[model samples]
Target: MIEILELTELPRAKAAGALVADILQTMRSRAAVGTNLLDIDEWTKAMIVEAGAESCYVDYAPSFGRGPFGHYICTSVNDAVLHGRPHDYTLADGDLLSLDLAVSLGGLVADSAISFVVGDARPAESLAMIDATERALSAGIAAAGPGARIGDISHAIGSVLGEAGYPINTEFGGHGVGSTMHQDPHVSNKGRPGRGYKLRPGLLLALEPWVMADTAELVTDTDGWTLKSATGCRTAHSEHTIAITEDGAEILTLPNHS
Candidate 1:
C-alpha cells in the first residue's frame, strides 16, 4: 500500500526515524571483533522495547523469507547483502558488517541500513564499496522532491553506482514506507528519469542503494534468509528514510553524530 502521512503524522514519523538512526549508530559502535551477531539482535530488541517501539522485522512473514523473521535486526556480513538473519557467528577483524533496521513508534514506521567495517582493519575494497553506496544514497535523496518522479531518484542513485563500477541488483531496492514497513511503489536502484510515480508532499520513501563488488547475482544462505553475492565478493549497502515536503525531501534517518 502507498501511504501518505498527514501533517500530524509527520512528527510521529520523525520520532520513529530518529529512533532507528540512533539505534543503528549505537549498534555500529558496539559491533567489533568477537561480537556475536546474535548479540546485536538482542541489543536491538532491548533498545526497541525501551523506546516503546515495535519491531517491523520480528514476526514478519514475507513471501521472500521464511515465516516469522524472529530477529530484531539484519546482520549481513562480508559478502552477505540483504535479508541477513542474525546468527551465532562472531565478527572478526576487518569484517564488513551491514545492519538493516526498521521499527514503528507512535503508529508510524521508519527503515534504514548502514554498512561498515567491524574492526580496525579496513580493507581498501570494503571502504570504497561503502563510500560508493553512501554517495549513491545522497544522490538519490537529492533527486527526490515534490513533483519529481520515482525514476529520477533511481537514475540519480544508479548513475553514482554505475560510475563507481559496481553491478546493480533490482530484485530488492527501496520502497514506500509508512504505518507499515514495506509498501509501494517499488523504487529500483536503476531507472530512467521522468518515469514511474510522481512524488507528492506527505509521501515517505526508503531509498537504498546496494552493490556487489563483482556480480549482481545473489545466492541465499542455508538459513533461508541471508542473501549473499554469487561470486562471494564483498558488498555494501546504504539506506535512509525521507519525507516529501513542499521545498524538497527531508531526510529523517540521519545519524545523530552526523
Candidate 2:
C-alpha cells in the first residue's frame, strides 16, 4: 500500500506529523526516574483524544503481536527495542527509554520515535549505543531526496552503524507511511545503493535506523511483541517520517516543541 499524498492533503499530513512529533518530544521530556511506562501510555491516549487523532497502536493486532496492542504508544526500556508494549514498569536512573508513536489526523498519519536515558547518570556504553543509532538516523536522512533509491538511504544508515561496530538487523526496518501507518518499500538498515524502488515526489517514508550494542540477533519478550537483544545487550532506535517533494526529502515529524 504505497500511498502518495495529493498536494491538497499534504498540509494535513504535515499537521499530523507535527502533532505526533510534539507529543513524542513532550513525553520524552516528562519521562524521568520513577516514571511509569503505563503512565506514559495513559498520557499519550489523552493527547490523541484531545487532538482528535487516532492511535495506530491501540487496535494493531498484526501476526507479530500477541493481540490488540491496547496501548497508545510503545514504551521500550533498555532491553526492549521494536514493538515495545507499554506495561507496568518503573523507569530507573540512567535507564535507556525509547518512545515510538504513530497517529492519524485529518485522514493522514505520521510515525516517529526517540531514545534517551533517564536521570543524570549517563553510562558510557549506553551513550555510545544511543549515539550510534542517532548518527545512523542522520545518515539515512541525508541519503533521502528526490529520485534517491531506498537502497541509497539504507546504505547511508548502515555505513554509520557498521563503522561504529554494531550489527544490523533487517527483520524490521523503516517503511513507506501514509493514510495508514506502515506501508510498502521496506527500507532495510543495511543495503547497497543503486537498488530497489526509485524515489519520487509526494511519497512518504519513515526512515528508522536502530541497532543493538553487540549482536544482530533478537528474541521476543514474554509479552509476545517487544524485541530484545539475544545477548541481552542494550539497544537504541531513532525514526522520523519524511515526505519527498520537488525540493528534496522533507521531514514531517519534527515536533515543534522539540
Candidate 3:
C-alpha cells in the first residue's frame, strides 16, 4: 500500500497537507479550559466540509480501532497519547491536549498531530515532554531525504527522545501516507540507521515522534480507541507529513496561516 506521488501529483499532496495543518492549528487555538472534546470534533468536521475535503478518520475502521472512528479529530488529554477518540470530557486548566488530524483533498491525504497545554497553567513536566517530542520530530524530518533510509529518520528521532530520558514505543509509529491515511514502510521511533527501506524522491512519509513521561507501556481506555500511558504519566506527540524530493524532504504539513 505504499504510494509514491508523481511529481505532477505533489501539488495536490501539498494542498492536502496544508489543509490538515491549518485545521490542527485552528483546533489547538480553539481548545482551552472548559472546551469539550466533542466540540473540537464538531469544529473539525465543519472545517472539512467547508473546504470540500474528506476526513480520513470518520468511517475509518482499522483493525486496531473499535469500529468506524466516528470522530473528525483525535482529542488526547493529559495521559492519552494516540488514537484518542473524542469524548464528552471537558478540558481543564493545565491539561495537556494533543490533536491529530488528517484530511483528503484533491484525492490526496495528509496527516499531522500537535501537543500543547490548554489554558494558562504551564506545567513544567508537560512542557518538557512536549518540547522533547517537538525536537524529536524536527530531528526526524532533518534525517529524511532522497537516498536516506527509513532507519536514519528513526534513529534521529530516537536519539532526541532517548537523550531527553523518555521511553520510546514502537507498537504505533509513523508510516507511509498518501491517497489513503496509513500505509506501509512502518517507521519506528527508535531504530538502527542504515537498516530499513531506502528513501527516494516522490515518497511521502508521516514522521511522528511521541513519548511517555515514565514508561513505554500503553493502556487502552474503555472507549476501545484512546491509548493512554500505563502509569498515567503525561504524554506528548508531534507529527508532520513530508514528501521526499530532489531538493530534500519537503514538509507539506506546515500551517499556511502561520
Off by over 4 Å in 2: none
Give the alpha carbon lDDT tens digit for every residue of 29-145 in model 2: 889899999999999999999999999999999988898988999998988888899899999999999899999999888999999999998899998988988889888888888
How many residue pairs of model 1 clash at the backbone?
0
Error of 1 at 84 (Å): 0.5
Q: Rank the candidates by lDDT, best first.
A: 1, 3, 2
Over 1-258, each residue of candidate 1 has an lDDT whose tens digit, in order, gives 789888888989999999999999999999989999999999999999999999999999899887789999999999999989999999999999999999999999999999999888969999999999999999999999999999999999999999999999999999999988999989999999999999999999999999999999999999889999999999999999999999999999998875
Evaluate model 2: give its lDDT: 0.91
Reference-based lDDT, each prediction = 0.96, 0.91, 0.93
Ten contiguous residues minimizing lDDT sum, candidate 2 = 249-258
**Candidate 1: stretches off by over 4 Å:** none
User: How far in Å is the alpha carbon of 101 misplaced in model 3?
Assistant: 0.3
Clashing pairs in 2: none
For candidate 2, the per-residue lDDT at 171 reads: 92
Residue-wise C-alpha lDDT for candidate 3, range 1-258, written one tens digit per residue: 778789999999999998998898889889989999999999999999999999998999988888998999998998999999999999999999999998899999899999999999989999999999999999999999999999999999999999999999999999999888899989999999998899989999999999999999999999989999999999999999999999799999998763
- Give the TM-score comparing model 1 with the true structure, all chains together: 0.99
Error of 2 at 157 (Å): 0.6
